[model samples]
Target: MKLYTHPDCEKHEMPGHPERPDRLRAVMQRLSESGMLDDINVELAEEISDETLAMVHPPDYIEAIKAAEPEEGLINVDPDTYMNNGSTRAAKLAAGACLQAVQDVLCGEEKRVFCATRPPGHHAELASAMGFCLFNNIAMAADYALRDERINRVAIVDFDVHHCNGTVDIFKERPEVMVCSSFQDNYYPNRYLDYTNEHMINLPMAPGSKGGEWRKRVEREWLGKLEDYKPDLLLISAGFDAHKDDPLAQIEFDESDYEWITQQLLNIAEKHCAARLISTMEGGYDLNALADCAEQHVRALI
Candidate 1:
């Protein structure tokens, strides 16, 4: 498995925010402590260019994000989102990591990749930044992957506690891209929770839902559709926020659940996509749970 991250990602944080730098630090520290990084191919993520980012975001919106970056302190983008001096570059690097991972996977340089970058992107819309996301990293990478003639179909599986409203906003009209998201019911960024098309699959779990119920729903709702779609590439918005220990939501997922989900996605990738899969970091609040869940997810990918 290939792992992509950058120090800049840890630089984007606020003092009292739940989505702070310690989240990334804890995950990375756990991987290092467990010697997992030693076995994986680790690469420093680079910044994505504005032109490429424009595939999913408009030029004006991109410019606005850059312009909103504060010189020293945090500036509020939304009620739950903030940006500091390092945020712009960190967000770009995070998005760039996904782009690089997609390119490498499609080019056959790697079969599976996990991007451990931050400023989670599943909630950022086409022209707005919210839910602690500046750019829709997975969406941008999917758009970038579709640029290649060989990749006609793409599937994004999101298991974040919150729905990927931004991803749905960007790809809802495009039938070639199928988005399967399992998130908590009545969660944050509550757009598209009930919206579904031929390609967009939304699985909203109840507040106290556990891994068993989630797995059952996945088998019933996602697996068949994924097999039928036969995507050329598979991308995952890997989020650990649904874990029971997480403070952000009420879902009762654990490390085992993350591993099981990863294994299922890997099976789909191997069968339909030639194992071409890339997962980008989304949300996971509690440090210990995030670290444990991320390690399990990567172990399954490996």
Candidate 2:
């Protein structure tokens, strides 16, 4: 497994925000302290070009995001999304890191890759930014893989506490991509598209739901769908906020649960795509829990 990270990812920040730089900092520090950092291949992320950003975002939307960057202080792009001086670059790098992860895994440089960049991108739409996300990183990576990697299909499995409304918006109609998202139903960003489309599998869990329910849903819903699709690549919207210890949502998952889920996904990956997988960080507010749970997720990958 390869781990892609960048210090600049911590530059996109707002004061006292739940989605702040300290989250990634804590994750990295904990990985180092736990000696997990020494076990995997670590690579610094490269800056993404405008052409790459255009793969998913339109020119106008990209320009608007760049124009929103403040010269000094913070500027609000949405009610929750904000941009500082370093935000635009950080957002590009975050998205680019996902692309790099895909390139590494598909070209046989690594069988699996985990991106630890920040400014979680699942909630950012094609034309707009939301939920503290500026650019839809995972969606862009999926697009890149299909277009450039000579892969027929890709499966995106999102376990964020909140729904990946942006990613669904991007590929809802594309049959070549299958997106399975399990989020707390009627929670933040409550408005969601109907899951009538064959490619979209939305698993809505209620508050207080435990890992047993999540595991059952994966076994019952995801495994069969994935078997039918037989995707060439497995992309994960890896969010740790579903943990019981996280303050963002009320889903009860422990570090072991993350490990278990990763193993389950790896089983499907091994059967379908020779274990080609790439995961990018999403939402995880509680630092301690995020660090510990992310470690376990990576441990499973190795």
Candidate 3:
């Protein structure tokens, strides 16, 4: 397993916000204290180029995001999203980390990779930034991976409390990519909650759903589709916000739930994709819960 992150990821912050820099700080601190970092390959993520970002986002939208960055104070992009001086670079690096992970896993340099960057991207759309996301990081990485002829099919599994509307929007018509998202029903970014297809699996659990409910639904809805698709690579939008302690939602999951889901994905990866999996951080607000869940996810990856 390998870990990719950048210091700039910690620079994109808004005071008193749930998506604050301390989120990453807490996860990193826990990983270090648990000696998990010592067991994995850690690399600083580079900023993604505009050319690559353009694969998912329009060029003008890219320029607009660049222009929206404030020099002195934070600028609001939406009700839940903000931009600061370091926001652009942080978003770039966050996306870049996933891109690099794609390259590394495909080239056989690593089997599993975890990107512990912030400003999660599962909510960002092709031409808009929302839900604290500036770019669709995993979507861009998936598009980048498909460039390699060897990777014909890719599966993206998102277990976030909120829906990965941006990911579903980008790849809804692309048959080559399969998106399986399990999120809280009637939740934030409510777009595409009712959308589903042969390649897109939207599993929406009711509010107050427990880990067992999530597991049964996933096993019934996701596992068989994943096996049938037989993806060449697996990507995870690993969000821990579904935890019982998270303030933003009403789900009851703990670190063990994360571990269980990771193992399930790992089994599929090992059977079909040479264990090639790249997981990037998404929504997880409670600092301690985020740290503990993230650590367990990484430990399972290891």
RMSD of each: 0.7, 1.0, 0.7
Clashing pairs in 2: none
lDDT of 1 by residue, 254-274 (tens): 889999999999999999999
Report the C-alpha lDDT of model 2 over 1-302, residue by residue, as the tens digit: 78999999888888999999999998899889988888888989988898889989998899988988989999999999999999998999899999999888778899999999988999998888999999999998899999864699999999989999999888888999999999998888865635647889999998999999889988998889989999999999999999999998899988888999899889889999888999999999999999998989988988
Model 2: residue 259 alpha-carbon error in angstroms: 0.6
- For model 2, the stretches where C-alpha displacement exceeds 4 angstroms are none
Native-referenced Cα lDDT, model 2: 0.90
User: Which candidate achieves the best lDDT against the true structure?
Assistant: 1
Give the per-residue lDDT of model 3 (tens digit) for 115-216. 999889999988989998899999988999999999999999999999999999899999999999988998789899999999999998888889988888
Which residue pairs show backbone clashes in model 3? none
- Provide TM-scores for the models: 0.99, 0.98, 0.99
Clashes of 1: 0
